[model samples]
Target: MDKKHLQTPSQTIGPFFAYGLTPTQYDYEFKSWVDNNMVADIDAPETIEISGTVFDGEGQAIDDAMVELWQDDGEHKLYGRFGTGTEENNRFIFKTIKPKSVNGQAPFINVILFMRGQLLHTYTRIYFADESSLNASDKVLNSVDAKRRNTLIAEKVGQKYSIDIHMQGQKETVFFDL
Candidate 1:
Protein backbone atom coordinates (compact mmCIF):
# COMPACT_ATOMS: atom_id res chain seq x y z
CA MET A 1 0.00 0.00 0.00
CA ASP A 2 1.44 3.35 -1.03
CA LYS A 3 0.61 6.10 1.48
CA LYS A 4 1.03 8.77 -1.18
CA HIS A 5 -1.64 7.16 -3.36
CA LEU A 6 -4.56 7.42 -0.95
CA GLN A 7 -7.87 7.73 -2.67
CA THR A 8 -9.73 11.02 -2.37
CA PRO A 9 -13.27 11.28 -1.10
CA SER A 10 -16.10 11.50 -3.60
CA GLN A 11 -17.28 14.97 -4.60
CA THR A 12 -20.52 16.44 -5.90
CA ILE A 13 -21.47 16.16 -9.57
CA GLY A 14 -20.46 19.64 -10.63
CA PRO A 15 -20.74 22.02 -13.59
CA PHE A 16 -18.33 20.27 -15.93
CA PHE A 17 -20.54 17.17 -16.12
CA ALA A 18 -22.27 18.32 -19.34
CA TYR A 19 -18.97 18.59 -21.25
CA GLY A 20 -17.71 15.35 -19.82
CA LEU A 21 -20.83 13.19 -19.98
CA THR A 22 -23.03 14.44 -22.82
CA PRO A 23 -21.37 17.32 -24.53
CA THR A 24 -22.99 16.73 -27.87
CA GLN A 25 -26.38 16.09 -26.37
CA TYR A 26 -26.47 18.86 -23.80
CA ASP A 27 -24.27 21.44 -25.49
CA TYR A 28 -23.74 22.21 -29.17
CA GLU A 29 -22.45 24.87 -31.53
CA PHE A 30 -25.39 25.35 -33.90
CA LYS A 31 -27.62 22.53 -32.80
CA SER A 32 -27.46 19.46 -30.54
CA TRP A 33 -25.54 16.64 -32.22
CA VAL A 34 -26.67 14.07 -29.67
CA ASP A 35 -30.13 12.96 -28.72
CA ASN A 36 -31.77 10.84 -26.07
CA ASN A 37 -31.74 7.77 -28.25
CA MET A 38 -32.58 4.30 -27.03
CA VAL A 39 -32.86 1.95 -29.99
CA ALA A 40 -30.37 1.21 -32.74
CA ASP A 41 -32.67 -0.82 -35.00
CA ILE A 42 -35.80 0.22 -36.83
CA ASP A 43 -37.07 -3.32 -36.35
CA ALA A 44 -36.79 -3.16 -32.62
CA PRO A 45 -39.83 -4.32 -30.71
CA GLU A 46 -42.04 -2.04 -28.58
CA THR A 47 -40.10 1.12 -29.26
CA ILE A 48 -41.38 3.99 -27.15
CA GLU A 49 -40.52 7.38 -25.75
CA ILE A 50 -39.83 7.76 -22.04
CA SER A 51 -39.88 11.16 -20.36
CA GLY A 52 -39.64 12.32 -16.76
CA THR A 53 -38.36 14.78 -14.27
CA VAL A 54 -35.81 14.70 -11.45
CA PHE A 55 -36.94 16.25 -8.20
CA ASP A 56 -35.00 16.93 -5.06
CA GLY A 57 -36.03 16.15 -1.51
CA GLU A 58 -37.68 19.56 -1.36
CA GLY A 59 -39.60 18.84 -4.54
CA GLN A 60 -37.51 21.14 -6.71
CA ALA A 61 -36.48 20.33 -10.24
CA ILE A 62 -32.76 19.78 -10.84
CA ASP A 63 -31.98 21.10 -14.29
CA ASP A 64 -28.27 20.48 -14.27
CA ALA A 65 -28.47 16.77 -13.61
CA MET A 66 -27.56 14.23 -16.26
CA VAL A 67 -29.46 11.01 -16.67
CA GLU A 68 -28.05 7.95 -18.38
CA LEU A 69 -29.83 4.76 -19.35
CA TRP A 70 -28.29 1.35 -19.96
CA GLN A 71 -30.11 -1.72 -21.13
CA ASP A 72 -30.15 -4.64 -23.54
CA ASP A 73 -30.82 -3.25 -27.02
CA GLY A 74 -33.97 -5.39 -27.46
CA GLU A 75 -31.68 -7.87 -29.15
CA HIS A 76 -29.00 -10.34 -28.11
CA LYS A 77 -26.65 -7.39 -27.75
CA LEU A 78 -25.42 -7.19 -24.16
CA TYR A 79 -25.94 -3.47 -23.47
CA GLY A 80 -26.34 0.06 -24.78
CA ARG A 81 -26.02 3.60 -23.44
CA PHE A 82 -28.23 6.70 -23.85
CA GLY A 83 -27.49 10.16 -22.62
CA THR A 84 -30.91 11.28 -21.39
CA GLY A 85 -30.20 14.97 -21.91
CA THR A 86 -31.12 17.32 -19.11
CA GLU A 87 -34.27 19.07 -20.22
CA GLU A 88 -33.60 22.30 -18.41
CA ASN A 89 -32.69 20.08 -15.45
CA ASN A 90 -36.42 19.52 -15.09
CA ARG A 91 -36.86 16.42 -17.21
CA PHE A 92 -35.20 13.97 -19.59
CA ILE A 93 -36.44 11.79 -22.37
CA PHE A 94 -35.27 8.55 -23.93
CA LYS A 95 -36.73 7.32 -27.17
CA THR A 96 -35.91 3.63 -27.13
CA ILE A 97 -37.19 0.16 -27.69
CA LYS A 98 -38.26 -1.62 -24.57
CA PRO A 99 -35.53 -3.99 -23.44
CA LYS A 100 -35.99 -7.71 -22.94
CA SER A 101 -35.02 -9.81 -19.97
CA VAL A 102 -31.37 -10.25 -19.09
CA ASN A 103 -30.30 -13.47 -17.34
CA GLY A 104 -33.93 -14.52 -16.72
CA GLN A 105 -34.58 -11.36 -14.74
CA ALA A 106 -37.42 -8.93 -15.33
CA PRO A 107 -36.84 -6.44 -18.12
CA PHE A 108 -35.59 -3.05 -16.96
CA ILE A 109 -33.46 -0.07 -17.86
CA ASN A 110 -30.56 0.59 -15.51
CA VAL A 111 -30.27 4.29 -14.71
CA ILE A 112 -27.46 6.42 -13.40
CA LEU A 113 -28.22 9.90 -12.09
CA PHE A 114 -25.56 12.57 -11.81
CA MET A 115 -26.57 15.73 -10.03
CA ARG A 116 -25.22 18.43 -7.78
CA GLY A 117 -25.16 17.66 -4.04
CA GLN A 118 -24.71 13.95 -4.72
CA LEU A 119 -21.24 12.79 -3.89
CA LEU A 120 -21.67 9.75 -6.08
CA HIS A 121 -24.08 9.02 -8.87
CA THR A 122 -27.33 7.39 -7.88
CA TYR A 123 -28.29 4.04 -9.39
CA THR A 124 -31.88 3.07 -10.09
CA ARG A 125 -34.08 1.17 -12.53
CA ILE A 126 -36.96 2.03 -14.82
CA TYR A 127 -39.42 -0.83 -15.17
CA PHE A 128 -42.19 -0.86 -17.71
CA ALA A 129 -45.69 -0.44 -16.37
CA ASP A 130 -46.97 -3.00 -18.87
CA GLU A 131 -44.69 -5.58 -17.29
CA SER A 132 -46.34 -5.36 -13.89
CA SER A 133 -46.59 -9.12 -13.74
CA LEU A 134 -42.90 -9.62 -14.45
CA ASN A 135 -41.95 -6.73 -12.20
CA ALA A 136 -43.68 -8.50 -9.34
CA SER A 137 -41.19 -11.35 -9.46
CA ASP A 138 -37.99 -9.49 -10.23
CA LYS A 139 -35.30 -10.37 -7.69
CA VAL A 140 -34.07 -6.79 -7.50
CA LEU A 141 -37.59 -5.40 -7.28
CA ASN A 142 -38.56 -8.01 -4.71
CA SER A 143 -35.85 -6.69 -2.40
CA VAL A 144 -37.84 -3.50 -1.93
CA ASP A 145 -41.17 -3.07 -0.19
CA ALA A 146 -44.35 -3.85 -2.07
CA LYS A 147 -45.55 -0.25 -1.86
CA ARG A 148 -42.22 1.36 -2.55
CA ARG A 149 -41.75 -0.85 -5.59
CA ASN A 150 -44.09 1.36 -7.53
CA THR A 151 -41.48 4.06 -7.47
CA LEU A 152 -39.44 2.03 -9.88
CA ILE A 153 -42.25 1.34 -12.31
CA ALA A 154 -42.93 3.71 -15.18
CA GLU A 155 -46.40 4.84 -16.17
CA LYS A 156 -47.41 4.18 -19.75
CA VAL A 157 -48.80 7.17 -21.55
CA GLY A 158 -50.56 7.19 -24.93
CA GLN A 159 -47.47 6.52 -27.02
CA LYS A 160 -44.83 7.22 -24.41
CA TYR A 161 -43.88 6.20 -20.89
CA SER A 162 -43.27 8.41 -17.89
CA ILE A 163 -41.02 7.74 -14.95
CA ASP A 164 -39.87 10.43 -12.58
CA ILE A 165 -36.85 10.16 -10.29
CA HIS A 166 -37.29 11.44 -6.76
CA MET A 167 -33.94 11.96 -5.14
CA GLN A 168 -35.24 11.95 -1.58
CA GLY A 169 -38.23 12.39 0.71
CA GLN A 170 -41.31 10.18 1.04
CA LYS A 171 -41.57 8.92 -2.51
CA GLU A 172 -37.88 8.58 -3.15
CA THR A 173 -36.93 6.22 -5.94
CA VAL A 174 -35.21 3.03 -4.89
CA PHE A 175 -31.47 3.45 -5.35
CA PHE A 176 -28.97 0.60 -5.49
CA ASP A 177 -25.36 0.18 -4.49
CA LEU A 178 -22.82 -0.12 -7.26
Candidate 2:
Protein backbone atom coordinates (compact mmCIF):
# COMPACT_ATOMS: atom_id res chain seq x y z
CA MET A 1 0.00 0.00 0.00
CA ASP A 2 1.13 3.54 -0.71
CA LYS A 3 1.95 5.73 2.27
CA LYS A 4 2.23 9.50 2.52
CA HIS A 5 5.73 10.92 2.72
CA LEU A 6 7.12 14.43 3.10
CA GLN A 7 8.83 15.74 0.00
CA THR A 8 12.54 16.52 0.27
CA PRO A 9 13.45 20.20 0.37
CA SER A 10 15.20 21.53 -2.68
CA GLN A 11 18.98 21.99 -2.37
CA THR A 12 21.62 24.16 -3.95
CA ILE A 13 23.90 23.00 -6.75
CA GLY A 14 26.76 22.92 -4.22
CA PRO A 15 30.51 23.58 -4.64
CA PHE A 16 31.42 20.16 -6.01
CA PHE A 17 29.26 20.40 -9.10
CA ALA A 18 32.06 21.54 -11.39
CA TYR A 19 33.68 18.14 -11.87
CA GLY A 20 30.38 16.59 -12.83
CA LEU A 21 28.54 19.48 -14.45
CA THR A 22 31.07 21.20 -16.69
CA PRO A 23 34.43 20.03 -18.02
CA THR A 24 35.91 23.50 -18.53
CA GLN A 25 36.25 23.77 -14.75
CA TYR A 26 39.33 21.48 -14.95
CA ASP A 27 40.97 23.17 -17.96
CA TYR A 28 39.55 20.59 -20.32
CA GLU A 29 37.45 21.30 -23.38
CA PHE A 30 33.75 21.09 -22.60
CA LYS A 31 32.33 17.95 -24.07
CA SER A 32 28.76 16.80 -23.49
CA TRP A 33 28.12 13.22 -24.43
CA VAL A 34 24.45 13.84 -25.02
CA ASP A 35 24.39 17.28 -26.65
CA ASN A 36 27.94 17.03 -28.06
CA ASN A 37 27.59 20.52 -29.55
CA MET A 38 27.04 23.87 -27.89
CA VAL A 39 26.43 26.06 -30.94
CA ALA A 40 22.98 25.69 -32.49
CA ASP A 41 23.39 26.67 -36.15
CA ILE A 42 20.26 25.61 -37.93
CA ASP A 43 19.94 27.87 -41.00
CA ALA A 44 20.95 31.25 -39.72
CA PRO A 45 23.00 33.52 -41.94
CA GLU A 46 25.68 34.05 -39.29
CA THR A 47 26.71 32.78 -35.90
CA ILE A 48 26.37 35.11 -32.95
CA GLU A 49 28.12 35.19 -29.61
CA ILE A 50 26.33 35.86 -26.35
CA SER A 51 28.06 36.29 -23.01
CA GLY A 52 27.41 37.75 -19.61
CA THR A 53 28.22 37.88 -15.91
CA VAL A 54 26.29 36.48 -12.97
CA PHE A 55 25.98 38.48 -9.78
CA ASP A 56 24.82 37.33 -6.38
CA GLY A 57 22.31 38.97 -4.08
CA GLU A 58 25.14 40.96 -2.53
CA GLY A 59 26.23 42.45 -5.90
CA GLN A 60 29.36 40.34 -6.09
CA ALA A 61 30.21 38.14 -9.05
CA ILE A 62 29.37 34.44 -8.80
CA ASP A 63 32.45 32.75 -10.18
CA ASP A 64 31.11 29.22 -10.29
CA ALA A 65 27.70 29.57 -11.78
CA MET A 66 26.62 27.47 -14.76
CA VAL A 67 24.20 28.38 -17.56
CA GLU A 68 22.07 26.13 -19.72
CA LEU A 69 20.55 27.40 -22.97
CA TRP A 70 17.55 26.00 -24.81
CA GLN A 71 15.94 27.83 -27.69
CA ASP A 72 12.27 27.25 -28.46
CA ASP A 73 12.99 26.72 -32.16
CA GLY A 74 14.65 23.36 -31.90
CA GLU A 75 13.85 22.28 -35.42
CA HIS A 76 17.35 20.78 -35.28
CA LYS A 77 17.34 19.43 -31.72
CA LEU A 78 20.36 21.34 -30.34
CA TYR A 79 21.23 22.80 -26.92
CA GLY A 80 24.04 24.59 -25.09
CA ARG A 81 25.58 24.46 -21.61
CA PHE A 82 28.39 26.52 -20.11
CA GLY A 83 30.24 27.12 -16.85
CA THR A 84 31.33 30.57 -15.74
CA GLY A 85 35.02 30.59 -15.02
CA THR A 86 36.68 31.93 -11.88
CA GLU A 87 38.29 34.76 -13.76
CA GLU A 88 38.97 38.08 -12.07
CA ASN A 89 35.53 39.03 -13.37
CA ASN A 90 33.10 36.12 -13.46
CA ARG A 91 31.47 35.55 -16.87
CA PHE A 92 30.08 32.95 -19.23
CA ILE A 93 29.81 32.92 -23.03
CA PHE A 94 27.89 31.05 -25.68
CA LYS A 95 28.25 30.76 -29.44
CA THR A 96 24.94 30.24 -31.18
CA ILE A 97 22.95 31.15 -34.22
CA LYS A 98 19.97 33.48 -34.27
CA PRO A 99 16.67 31.72 -33.60
CA LYS A 100 13.30 32.09 -35.30
CA SER A 101 10.03 32.98 -33.66
CA VAL A 102 8.37 30.00 -31.97
CA ASN A 103 4.57 29.76 -31.85
CA GLY A 104 4.29 33.40 -32.98
CA GLN A 105 6.29 34.48 -29.93
CA ALA A 106 9.44 36.60 -30.03
CA PRO A 107 12.60 34.63 -30.64
CA PHE A 108 14.46 34.22 -27.38
CA ILE A 109 17.03 32.00 -25.77
CA ASN A 110 15.82 30.32 -22.61
CA VAL A 111 18.41 30.42 -19.83
CA ILE A 112 18.64 28.65 -16.50
CA LEU A 113 21.12 29.76 -13.86
CA PHE A 114 22.63 27.47 -11.21
CA MET A 115 24.89 29.06 -8.71
CA ARG A 116 25.90 28.99 -5.06
CA GLY A 117 23.44 30.18 -2.45
CA GLN A 118 20.57 29.36 -4.82
CA LEU A 119 18.46 26.45 -3.65
CA LEU A 120 16.75 26.20 -7.03
CA HIS A 121 17.89 27.25 -10.45
CA THR A 122 16.42 30.46 -11.82
CA TYR A 123 14.85 30.75 -15.27
CA THR A 124 15.16 33.73 -17.61
CA ARG A 125 15.01 34.60 -21.30
CA ILE A 126 17.31 36.62 -23.54
CA TYR A 127 15.53 38.60 -26.23
CA PHE A 128 17.35 40.46 -28.95
CA ALA A 129 17.40 44.24 -28.67
CA ASP A 130 16.84 44.72 -32.39
CA GLU A 131 13.56 42.83 -32.63
CA SER A 132 11.39 45.83 -31.84
CA SER A 133 8.24 44.54 -33.52
CA LEU A 134 8.49 41.06 -32.08
CA ASN A 135 9.57 42.33 -28.67
CA ALA A 136 6.65 44.73 -28.53
CA SER A 137 4.07 42.02 -29.13
CA ASP A 138 5.62 39.14 -27.25
CA LYS A 139 3.16 37.78 -24.71
CA VAL A 140 5.80 36.65 -22.22
CA LEU A 141 7.54 40.01 -22.39
CA ASN A 142 4.37 42.05 -22.28
CA SER A 143 3.38 40.17 -19.13
CA VAL A 144 6.11 42.09 -17.31
CA ASP A 145 5.89 45.81 -16.63
CA ALA A 146 7.24 47.74 -19.59
CA LYS A 147 9.75 49.51 -17.34
CA ARG A 148 11.43 46.23 -16.40
CA ARG A 149 11.43 44.68 -19.83
CA ASN A 150 14.97 45.84 -20.52
CA THR A 151 16.31 43.22 -18.15
CA LEU A 152 15.50 40.50 -20.65
CA ILE A 153 16.94 42.17 -23.73
CA ALA A 154 20.57 41.61 -24.65
CA GLU A 155 22.75 44.50 -25.73
CA LYS A 156 24.51 44.03 -29.02
CA VAL A 157 28.28 44.52 -28.85
CA GLY A 158 30.30 44.10 -32.03
CA GLN A 159 29.89 40.41 -32.80
CA LYS A 160 28.55 39.48 -29.38
CA TYR A 161 25.52 40.16 -27.28
CA SER A 162 25.72 40.83 -23.54
CA ILE A 163 23.08 40.23 -20.92
CA ASP A 164 23.97 40.28 -17.25
CA ILE A 165 22.03 38.45 -14.55
CA HIS A 166 21.49 40.27 -11.30
CA MET A 167 20.17 37.80 -8.76
CA GLN A 168 18.72 40.43 -6.45
CA GLY A 169 18.38 44.16 -5.85
CA GLN A 170 16.56 46.67 -8.03
CA LYS A 171 18.29 45.60 -11.22
CA GLU A 172 17.39 41.95 -10.83
CA THR A 173 16.65 40.19 -14.09
CA VAL A 174 13.07 39.10 -14.72
CA PHE A 175 12.95 35.44 -13.76
CA PHE A 176 10.02 33.14 -14.46
CA ASP A 177 8.72 30.34 -12.28
CA LEU A 178 8.60 27.97 -15.19
Candidate 3:
Protein backbone atom coordinates (compact mmCIF):
# COMPACT_ATOMS: atom_id res chain seq x y z
CA MET A 1 0.00 0.00 0.00
CA ASP A 2 1.33 3.42 -0.84
CA LYS A 3 0.96 6.39 1.47
CA LYS A 4 0.02 8.58 -1.44
CA HIS A 5 -3.42 7.99 -2.94
CA LEU A 6 -3.37 6.38 -6.36
CA GLN A 7 -6.09 6.72 -8.98
CA THR A 8 -8.28 3.63 -9.46
CA PRO A 9 -11.22 2.95 -11.75
CA SER A 10 -14.73 3.38 -10.40
CA GLN A 11 -16.37 1.36 -13.13
CA THR A 12 -18.73 -1.28 -11.78
CA ILE A 13 -17.79 -4.83 -12.67
CA GLY A 14 -20.76 -6.55 -11.02
CA PRO A 15 -23.79 -6.11 -8.82
CA PHE A 16 -21.91 -3.96 -6.28
CA PHE A 17 -21.41 -0.28 -6.97
CA ALA A 18 -18.90 2.48 -6.19
CA TYR A 19 -18.23 4.01 -2.81
CA GLY A 20 -21.22 4.24 -0.40
CA LEU A 21 -22.49 0.98 -1.73
CA THR A 22 -25.69 1.02 0.26
CA PRO A 23 -26.09 -2.25 2.13
CA THR A 24 -29.61 -3.25 1.27
CA GLN A 25 -31.63 -3.94 4.38
CA TYR A 26 -33.93 -6.38 2.61
CA ASP A 27 -33.70 -8.87 5.43
CA TYR A 28 -35.70 -7.66 8.35
CA GLU A 29 -33.84 -9.94 10.71
CA PHE A 30 -30.68 -7.92 10.20
CA LYS A 31 -32.36 -5.03 12.00
CA SER A 32 -31.77 -6.62 15.37
CA TRP A 33 -28.04 -6.58 14.95
CA VAL A 34 -27.80 -2.93 13.92
CA ASP A 35 -29.93 -1.88 16.83
CA ASN A 36 -28.34 -1.16 20.17
CA ASN A 37 -28.40 -4.85 21.02
CA MET A 38 -25.20 -5.70 19.19
CA VAL A 39 -21.84 -5.22 20.82
CA ALA A 40 -20.56 -2.72 18.23
CA ASP A 41 -23.51 -0.57 19.17
CA ILE A 42 -22.89 -0.90 22.90
CA ASP A 43 -21.05 2.36 23.02
CA ALA A 44 -23.69 4.42 21.30
CA PRO A 45 -21.70 7.60 20.96
CA GLU A 46 -18.33 5.98 21.42
CA THR A 47 -16.91 5.62 17.97
CA ILE A 48 -14.55 2.70 17.61
CA GLU A 49 -11.84 4.06 15.38
CA ILE A 50 -10.88 1.65 12.61
CA SER A 51 -7.90 3.19 10.93
CA GLY A 52 -5.29 1.49 8.76
CA THR A 53 -3.18 2.34 5.76
CA VAL A 54 -3.27 -0.33 3.10
CA PHE A 55 0.32 -1.32 2.54
CA ASP A 56 2.33 -3.66 0.38
CA GLY A 57 5.02 -6.06 1.62
CA GLU A 58 7.55 -3.32 0.92
CA GLY A 59 5.65 -1.17 3.43
CA GLN A 60 3.96 1.29 1.09
CA ALA A 61 0.36 2.43 1.46
CA ILE A 62 -2.02 1.52 -1.33
CA ASP A 63 -4.00 4.65 -2.04
CA ASP A 64 -7.59 5.01 -3.26
CA ALA A 65 -8.56 1.50 -2.23
CA MET A 66 -12.12 0.90 -1.08
CA VAL A 67 -12.69 -1.58 1.73
CA GLU A 68 -16.07 -3.21 2.47
CA LEU A 69 -16.72 -5.15 5.66
CA TRP A 70 -19.50 -7.43 6.91
CA GLN A 71 -19.88 -9.11 10.29
CA ASP A 72 -22.34 -11.10 12.37
CA ASP A 73 -24.39 -9.69 15.21
CA GLY A 74 -22.19 -9.98 18.29
CA GLU A 75 -25.16 -10.03 20.68
CA HIS A 76 -25.75 -13.78 20.59
CA LYS A 77 -28.00 -13.52 17.57
CA LEU A 78 -29.33 -17.08 17.25
CA TYR A 79 -29.21 -17.01 13.47
CA GLY A 80 -26.38 -14.87 12.15
CA ARG A 81 -23.67 -16.18 9.88
CA PHE A 82 -20.24 -14.71 10.54
CA GLY A 83 -18.53 -15.17 7.20
CA THR A 84 -21.53 -15.77 4.95
CA GLY A 85 -21.98 -12.06 4.11
CA THR A 86 -25.62 -12.30 5.17
CA GLU A 87 -25.89 -9.55 7.68
CA GLU A 88 -27.70 -6.51 6.36
CA ASN A 89 -26.23 -3.04 6.63
CA ASN A 90 -24.29 -4.80 9.29
CA ARG A 91 -22.04 -2.39 7.52
CA PHE A 92 -21.30 0.01 10.27
CA ILE A 93 -18.20 2.15 10.24
CA PHE A 94 -15.08 0.45 8.94
CA LYS A 95 -14.41 -0.08 12.64
CA THR A 96 -16.51 -2.95 14.01
CA ILE A 97 -17.34 -4.50 17.34
CA LYS A 98 -15.07 -7.19 18.66
CA PRO A 99 -16.39 -10.54 17.43
CA LYS A 100 -17.04 -13.32 19.92
CA SER A 101 -16.65 -17.09 19.86
CA VAL A 102 -19.46 -19.57 19.62
CA ASN A 103 -19.48 -23.38 19.55
CA GLY A 104 -15.70 -23.28 19.66
CA GLN A 105 -15.92 -21.41 16.40
CA ALA A 106 -14.34 -18.00 16.67
CA PRO A 107 -16.01 -15.20 14.71
CA PHE A 108 -14.66 -13.35 11.69
CA ILE A 109 -15.78 -10.55 9.36
CA ASN A 110 -15.70 -10.47 5.57
CA VAL A 111 -13.81 -7.80 3.65
CA ILE A 112 -13.98 -6.92 -0.05
CA LEU A 113 -11.43 -4.47 -1.37
CA PHE A 114 -11.53 -2.57 -4.64
CA MET A 115 -8.42 -0.84 -5.85
CA ARG A 116 -8.27 1.83 -8.49
CA GLY A 117 -7.14 0.62 -11.92
CA GLN A 118 -6.62 -2.91 -10.62
CA LEU A 119 -8.58 -5.55 -12.45
CA LEU A 120 -8.63 -7.90 -9.54
CA HIS A 121 -10.90 -7.28 -6.58
CA THR A 122 -9.44 -8.67 -3.37
CA TYR A 123 -11.46 -10.62 -0.82
CA THR A 124 -10.39 -11.29 2.75
CA ARG A 125 -11.77 -12.16 6.16
CA ILE A 126 -10.70 -10.19 9.24
CA TYR A 127 -10.56 -11.71 12.70
CA PHE A 128 -11.68 -10.03 15.88
CA ALA A 129 -9.43 -8.79 18.68
CA ASP A 130 -6.51 -11.19 18.84
CA GLU A 131 -5.93 -10.64 22.52
CA SER A 132 -9.02 -12.66 23.32
CA SER A 133 -8.64 -16.38 23.98
CA LEU A 134 -11.04 -17.03 21.13
CA ASN A 135 -8.32 -16.04 18.69
CA ALA A 136 -6.67 -19.35 19.53
CA SER A 137 -9.86 -21.31 18.86
CA ASP A 138 -11.32 -19.63 15.77
CA LYS A 139 -12.02 -22.34 13.24
CA VAL A 140 -11.35 -20.10 10.24
CA LEU A 141 -8.10 -18.84 11.69
CA ASN A 142 -7.26 -22.36 12.78
CA SER A 143 -7.91 -23.68 9.29
CA VAL A 144 -5.35 -21.36 7.73
CA ASP A 145 -1.64 -22.20 7.88
CA ALA A 146 0.09 -20.86 10.97
CA LYS A 147 2.50 -18.75 8.90
CA ARG A 148 -0.41 -16.97 7.18
CA ARG A 149 -2.73 -16.46 10.13
CA ASN A 150 -1.19 -13.15 11.11
CA THR A 151 -2.25 -11.70 7.81
CA LEU A 152 -5.90 -11.97 8.83
CA ILE A 153 -5.77 -9.94 12.01
CA ALA A 154 -5.99 -6.17 12.58
CA GLU A 155 -4.46 -4.40 15.52
CA LYS A 156 -6.84 -2.26 17.57
CA VAL A 157 -5.45 1.12 18.54
CA GLY A 158 -7.42 2.84 21.27
CA GLN A 159 -10.51 4.20 19.48
CA LYS A 160 -8.88 3.43 16.16
CA TYR A 161 -7.85 0.13 14.60
CA SER A 162 -5.08 -0.19 12.03
CA ILE A 163 -4.24 -2.85 9.43
CA ASP A 164 -2.26 -2.00 6.33
CA ILE A 165 -3.14 -4.18 3.36
CA HIS A 166 -0.48 -5.06 0.82
CA MET A 167 -2.04 -5.27 -2.61
CA GLN A 168 0.05 -6.48 -5.50
CA GLY A 169 2.85 -7.07 -3.04
CA GLN A 170 4.30 -9.86 -0.98
CA LYS A 171 2.68 -10.87 2.31
CA GLU A 172 -0.80 -9.77 1.36
CA THR A 173 -3.83 -10.41 3.54
CA VAL A 174 -5.27 -13.90 3.19
CA PHE A 175 -7.77 -13.43 0.37
CA PHE A 176 -10.85 -15.62 -0.11
CA ASP A 177 -10.10 -15.88 -3.85
CA LEU A 178 -13.80 -15.69 -4.61
Winning model by lDDT? 2
Superposition error at 35 for model 1 (Å): 3.9
Where does candidate 2 clash, by residue pair?
none
Question: Best-fitting candidate, measured by TM-score?
Answer: 2
**Superposed model 3: Cα runs more than 4 Å off:** 1-47, 56-59, 74-93
Clash count list over all predictions: 1, 0, 15
Positional deviation of 151 in candidate 1, in angstroms? 0.6
TM-score per candidate: 0.81, 0.85, 0.58
**TM-score of candidate 3 relative to the true fold:** 0.58
- Give model 2's TM-score versus the native structure: 0.85
Tens-digit lDDT track of model 2 for 1-178: 5998888887898776766777654455664442213554455567888888898889988888878887757564457877676544877777787688877888898898887788988899999998889999999999998888999999997878999999888988999989
The 10-residue segment of model 1 with minimum total lDDT is: 76-85
- Every candidate's CA RMSD: 3.7, 3.1, 12.0
Error of 1 at 137 (Å): 1.5
**Residue 132 displacement (Å), model 1:** 1.6
lDDT of 1 by residue, 74-104 (tens): 5633233334344655678777877777776
